[model samples]
Target: MDVVTRCVHRESSVEEIMIYTGKSKSYVKSAISAAILLGMIEQLNGDIYKISDDCYGILNTTPSEELKTSLFKSRIEKWEPFILYLKYLISGESSVVAIRKLCSLYSFNRTPVQIENLLKNWAKSTGILDATGEIVDINLSYDENEILYKLNEETVNDTNVSLFMINILGENIFSWLYHDEIAELKKAILIFRDHPRDAIQCSGRAFEDVLRRISIQSGVDTRKLNGITQVANNLYSQLDSTDNPFIHSKLKNIASAIGDIRNMAGHGKEAKSMERWELSSTSAIAHLLLTLSTIKGIYSYVNENRYDF
Candidate 1:
């Protein structure tokens, strides 16, 4: 914290930080590196460093403990290794076991002992783990827990999916989406755990809404679009001839799947035995996430090259 505070006040080199903190050269260097890792500071030139722009609030006035903790938590939440560690803890793994898994999965270029100490220190400091290295009752929000569960289950096969989902939820990746579209997606994510069916419905609606917007922008006659599939296909057909046929075909399939899932949620098998058509909560949540991911990818491509579409 002292190193960060020093950097916040002025850009400092390693020697300057050592002089300001009255610490040994090695200790100052290590502190600066840790500060950079935690996103409290950023390297400027070769050796000089300053507080990160997002952390400038700590420049002059003393921040409250709540603000400090919020900053710490937000920064660490973006750290992949720390996120993996938290996922293991959420899945009932012991700290030792989680540390071992993390070590095996990622090469941190540090000794196991060093990695263990670093994780424990960050975990304890952020109140995520206690002194005993056990998870605390922090009452994680539904979406946060859902993300952790997905990361724990799916990262082994496709690590990028977990990270992409995390960024979608945590960052401003949806700026391309209109206000109402963004609101619907947020609604889906918010109720995905308790109201899985409704969540999937919301996700489907949001995705369909995007398709309709794109179709209209591309001069397609949306009046003839009967459902998401038609809307999606019409839009895809309008894509430039240079677009890859394989990608176009795959996107159409994904959009069609979203419509099919929405229909399953929208209509039950029979009024007498509605449960027959009801999807499991797990399946519904998975479908909702998949729909969101699909929307994210397609929307991003269209947004970047709107004129082409």
Candidate 2:
């Protein structure tokens, strides 16, 4: 039967084999049984059987030929997470400087230019299009310049910040900050944070929530989210790394620590000033401010390096 299957599928059958090789009937029966167990053929209604769809190639290909196949099973690999990080950078919840840091951490098949192009395509698809498309640009009395500058940095705080001005500032921060912390904690915070009363911590709280949700959705089979909890921890370590070429580790630690505090504030965690320089959170905020100041210098350095590139 095995010889018969090969003969019919590749031009050879059982009776033909018996005539050609003079095989005994019992030998033919044993061969057929072996072929059936191999799944090269599927039994149909009663005795009639057909070759399996997979068997067509199996019958033709050399063993080595089967090993060569495309590995790109899906698009939800590291690339998707890279795009998310880019959005975080653009939205001011994270920094563009993060790109270099992440590149250093992960080996990728894509170059920075390729990554940028990929992001350009994804941004267009997701309505992140051009930066200009982002704002309503209502031409309101508020200063767009100030808003952009404030967004260029999320740590900005001053007495002069107006109630409405703070509102807009908070929105940008919240939009990107949703992926900042562990998701459940972030979600619990959001249940309380979305209130009109919860403005300051909205950015960080929302950021953590977004990341957690993404991590959860990318199930084990999805590839990218398989080890995402560790990925988040790595991202946190880098963002909080003192040797980050942008800020000291102490400041990074403060940034991450205050991130939780900000969540507490957003979730109605009581009398939380959420303010940086309040004597209690002072030195931490100054170093944070110092980190921001260092970021500005790094921004300049990054651009200069980009141009040279």
Candidate 3:
């Protein structure tokens, strides 16, 4: 918080950050790196940093503790190491056991005691665990149904997909996505339970917007791009031939699938004097999950090959 607050007023380098926070150089650097990853700050051209556009409002204001906690939780939802630790706790593992397991899975230069302290701090702040390292709750504001929804044959649940979407919308990843693109997905998630049909349409808009963003970033002339299918196909052709052919094909398929669902949700036809379009809450949830998953995949691929693009 101190680091963010200092940066909010002006761009700061590592030395400035250390002085402002009254911390050692190494600690300040780590904090900066974490803040960058969380999308709370951005490093500028000359190694100076400032508060990110998406996060300036929260850090610049006198944010309440509740608001800070919510922001922190959303930022870290996609962090694999923390998510793994949470899973261990949910499976009834002690804090010590979970820390050990986490160490085995990820390389940590810190000793077990240090890692335990760090994990405990995060857990407590997120309200998932107590100071004693006991489980407080695992839902993290989501209900059981939203977290545990079964999506056909796919093993991934709604919670996992929702976390990924939140990460994207929060600008933790794919920060280049526009404000409206992010807002559409947020609207879809917020209304899915009460307005499934509207949620589906919102999800479709978000998906299309993401594809268009990718196209623009890749230097495609989007002036002629008409719909989701055309934009996706244009992107697929732009991929290097040496890259994975399977992913290229899958990108097109995913975009087509999303476009089909969006069209169905937005427009229904009458056949045999009977209306043929319908959507349940479960179906909307499933579609939104798929949309989030697809966006994550595309963004991950883009990030990995950004230099090539």
Per-model TM-score versus the true fold: 0.52, 0.23, 0.56
Report the number of the highest-TM-score candidate.
3
- The alpha-carbon deviation from the true structure for residue 202 of candidate 1, after best TM-score superposition, in angstroms, is 16
Give the RMSD in angstroms, all C-alphas superposed, for model 2. 20.5
Residue 262 error for model 2, in Å? Answer: 16
Residue-wise lDDT of candidate 3 within 1-309, one digit each (tens)?
A: 677778878888888888877999888887887788667889998879998887787665456677777777767664556666666666678878978877876677779888788778877888877777787764432333444353332333333544445443322343345546756776676667678889999989988888887766766666777777777877877755465422356767987888887777887686566676878887887788788778777776665642210
> Which lDDT tens digits does candidate 1 get at residues 89-128?
7778877787787777666767878887888898788787
Cα lDDT tens digits, model 2, 204-256, are 44333443443343321223432223324433344222343322333335445
Candidate 3 least-lDDT 10 residues: 150-159
lDDT of each: 0.68, 0.36, 0.69
TM-score comparison, 1 vs 2, better candidate: 1
User: What TM-score would you give candidate 3 relative to the actual structure?
Assistant: 0.56
Give lDDT: candidate 1, residue 207. 84
Off by over 4 Å in 1: 58-61, 64-66, 141-252, 255-288, 292-309
